[model samples]
Target: MEKPLILVTNDDGITAPGIRALIKVMNKLGTVCVVAPDSPQSGMGHAITVNDTLYCDAVVVDKDAPQKEYRCSGTPVDCVKLAVNEILGRKPDLCVSGINHGSNSSINVLYSGTMSAAVEAGTQGIPSIGFSLLDYSLEADFEPVLEHVEILAKQCLEHGLPTGVVLNVNFPKVSKEGIKGIKVCRQADAHWVERFDKRVNPLGREYYWLSGDFVNNDKGEDTDEWALANDYISVVPVQFDMTAYQALNQLNNWNFSQ
Candidate 1:
């Protein structure tokens, strides 16, 4: 059997340690091709380059690595689009994004370029997964999560994800032994309490820096937030469909003819 072709990408740019570590694991599983942002695009969500020209160039970030890599000057979603539409000659068997520097759990998925890349691939009928670590540091250790990453990716390849669904996997910042297990769970009903730090620049211009505290009010033990808090890796299946099916019947009862 031919080795499965795997497409790997991330929002943290091509040379990020997170991605480099991911490539190492992927190379062991199958043929790997990386198409990622040329620079950090952390909270870009599913944005595409519409107003500006896009560029994707072949590059050798690690000459020793076997995978062919491209550095794209666009959002994370743009990388997947280019990979699928232009780069790869055939549809990839699997698409994996991130090993991101921070968490993409719960509501953060709405603002994450990492998860958005996976969501983009999922929309194209590819089995996709977005992996994130709870630590937000540039030098955060990803060793503990590598085993779980391999396991999940292998499982995805073995048993394809449901139509239009992608996986959002988040790992706690713990040692390999500290990890309890993996939990397939739902997104926690949580949100950020935000504030803007208004300040003046050296030229006396006003500026605002966005900041916030994460508040989890949902006490459900089956949520992604709860799983991470208890040292288990959380895997939430996300779908691209945004329709509210329950609201259809309720709105149909309204008197629109009057």
Candidate 2:
């Protein structure tokens, strides 16, 4: 049997240690192809380069790097689109994004380029998974998530994902005892209590720095927040469909005939 062709990508440019670690692990499972950002693009969400020209160039940073690696001058989503539409000779068996340097649990997924890449792949009918570490450090240890990622990726390749859903896996920063295990859970009811710091720059122009604290109000033990708090890797099945089925019947009663 031919080795599974895996497409790897991330929000954090091609050389980030997180992606480098992910690529290293993926290379062991199959033929790996990477098309990631040329520079850090954290918090970019699903934005694509519409107003600017896009560029993708072949590059190498490691002696042990995958044979097919391209750096993209676009968002994480754009990389997936390009990889599927132009780069790869055939549709990849899997698309894996991240091993990201921070948590993408709960509402963070809305602003995550890491998860966006996987979400884009899922939309394109590819089995996809996004991996994240709770640690926000650039040098965050990826060793803890390696086994968990391998198991999940292998399962997806063997079993395939349910249509329209992709996995969002997040690992808590490793402690002295290391990661406990995996927990399949739902996203917690959470929100960021945000504020902006208004200040003046050197040019005397006012600017604002966005800041916030994540608040989780759900006490449910079956949520991603709870799993991550307990030191287990959390896997939440996420779907891109934002339609509210329950609201359809409620809105249908409104008078619009006039």
Could you say which candidate leads in TM-score? 1
**Each prediction's TM-score versus the true structure:** 0.98, 0.97
Residue-level lDDT tens digits of model 2 in 39-77: 999999989889999999988878765558999999999
What is candidate 1's lDDT per residue for 79-107, written digit by digit as tens?
Answer: 99999999998889999999899999999
lDDT of every model, 2 decimals: 0.96, 0.92
Candidate 1, 118: how far from true, in Å?
Answer: 0.2
Which parts of model 2 are misplaced by more than 4 Å?
Answer: none
